[model samples]
Target: MSLVVTTNVAGMNSQRALSIADRQLTTSLERLSSGSRINRAADDASNLAISEGLRAQIGGFRVALRNTQDGISVLQTAEGALTETQGILHRMRDLSVQAANAGSLDDDARGNLQSEIGQLRNELDRIAGTTSFNGRKLLDGGYRTVFHVGADAGHTIAVDLGRGTSAAALGVDGIDVTGPGRYGPGAVTLSTAAAPGTAAVLTIAAAGGSAGFSGGTGGVSAYTDLDGTISVGGRSFDLASVRYDTAADTDGNGTRDAADLLAQLNRAAIVALGLTSPPFSSPTPGTLAFAVAEPLPGHTGTAGAPLSASAADLARSTPTFTAAGGASRALTAIDAAIERISTVRGDLGAVQNRLEHNIAKLGVALDNTAASDSRIRDTDMATEMTAFTRTQILSQAGTAMLAQAHAAPQGVLKLLV
Candidate 1:
């Protein structure tokens, strides 16, 4: 090599090598400090983006799992309430059986039994109205609760817990007028109640209809869909867009003796059909008693003398349990109520099971996703430490070589001397 003082080519090469070593050492330190290889986007931009997405998914799964847990808890609350209602119903059934033994019991004894039974019915109504979860009603047929089961849109589960405790919903609110044989003597009563000069005699049955939301499925579809024409004042009201429940309607134009006619009346039941309030009678499960207008253009009766109710309209409304055979009717109503509670509990159990599975699946997914994200972004401590050692040795050697190269220029001074 030529003796050069001003231009030190060897020094320049040594400095370049040192810079490379220093850069490697710095990268190793950064990984050690952060415990991650991709500390910055520059470290691995593509992989950083991928890991970030995985992190987002993991977070969502965690929240979704919690939501599923909450849904299970809510279902449990509802199931517990139904269990208690079932006990109350069982007791009521026992009382009704005791009351039905009219041959062995006196009127006063039966009346006492009936009063207790009435209180039980009130309790049922109370449960239906008060059972709730986080302020949402459970058994009033109103809770259509939902849970998030997955980390994406449209990934959810629903709890369709309908009115399991309501007297009307359970078919327990009235008498067992589902069958003609179920009626006893005096189950129906008819008397003259007419506007001045009107001599129409009206009759009302004490037993309710056989058809209602009775089956485990609630025949809810029947209650929902009702498309029919109810003639009032010689005009009609369209029942179009009623719901899916009334599709299997077995009412209307049937023989007067047939239960179908009564059931149809029950489905298209009218509560306030009077021109004015001659009297307002609350419905009994198997019976109805109220005066309605004659529906004549100008002959509608006043409040004190409302027209006799249309027989057709009277038949359409739900029936109540009659005073004559109320005990036997109560037994039948209790049975139906018990069935409804069981059905609701079973449905809630099914939903809870599904939610448990959802939570477990979410946990597994989160674990696996974390593993994948770790592989994409986590630093290999052993491998990074090895690189740091190599760079440290290189840096020291480069410094020594730079000093030697700078000293090489002193040889040029020897030549000059």
Candidate 2:
């Protein structure tokens, strides 16, 4: 309040006030344009940090929703395939029941019924093995699926539907080829029978045989009545084409019998019989014996249950209606298979329902989280505009005052004059 010629302190005070008002006005304009309360760390550092965290969570939730949808799709694929398997199993069961009526279903009719039943069983195996989702095998029991449902560890949904229900897994017993094999009935005795890997000659013959070979002719052609192709363990081999010699008899002196024929059956024949060579047994003169073993190449695993077949293909097998009650056992197996398939379908349906609910929950969570984040980070347009208008008035008033203060020095000039 002093009239001094040396300094105009009033003008300097007005200039400082004007600068403060101008800076505030610019800040209000920026807030209005960006529609954000915290444009930078300086605006509201705490709230900006908090909003960032919330945004990350919202993103995670969206990803989890997508994962859930994908899981549902995969389950749907498996469910459809299992449904078809159920229908096939039901048809097989019906056929088995009909075939069981021994008097009504004669040998020929039963044979036809069994043929259809076998086809159905094979179809079941095919569906179980080949059903897939997004190139991942679903029904093969080899896939173990996991989906992350939350942003943190241990927040996942796991689905483990192990190897699907194949016909073999359903306990559908395969056909018994040639009943029980043994070293008898024209048993050809080995000169020196080695355990498993030993190769020796069939030198002697005991009577009671299907085919007799006379050493007089050097080689009596081949074994009779054993020329047809026999199927074993889902493989077929022609026994007629395979040549059997009593240790390469040079002068027709080697005594060849039915055992020699069985031992020297073709590789294909051996595989078809489902028995590995060198069956452990001392060969009688005319016969040799081997226990009937279903070539389960990889069914019974090295540790208890293996999955690989020697050929990596499940035996394409069917039951033959040869026994008196063959159909009865088949009917039981079909019933069990049906029950198992039903269980699988039920599980899929339940999971689908659960996932639908999970999606709904995710949607709710996303909406709420966005709302929370908006409250923390978004500007109130009405509030910002009001502040901007006020700052505009203050800046205009400050400019006028600053000019008046600067002119206040003119009062000193008037005193000088």
Q: Best candidate per TM-score, number?
A: 1
Weakest 10 consecutive residues, lDDT, candidate 2?
303-312
Count of residue pairs whose backbone atoms collide, per candidate: 29, 19
For model 1, the local distance difference test gives 0.63
Over the full model, what C-alpha lDDT does candidate 2 score relative to the true structure?
0.61
Residues 1-417, model 1: lDDT tens digits: 567678999999999999999999999999987989998899999999999999999899988988988888888888888898899889888888887777787767876876776787788889989988888888888777567789989998876887557766776665322222222322222223334344333222212323322221322123222323333221233333333333343544322222443344434433211111222232322222332322223223333232244333443343232123556666766888788788778888888888888888999999999999999999999999999999999999999999998998887666677
User: How many clashing pairs in candidate 2?
Assistant: 19
The Cα local distance difference test for each model comes to: 0.63, 0.61
RMSD of each: 12.1, 14.0
Best by the lDDT measure: 1
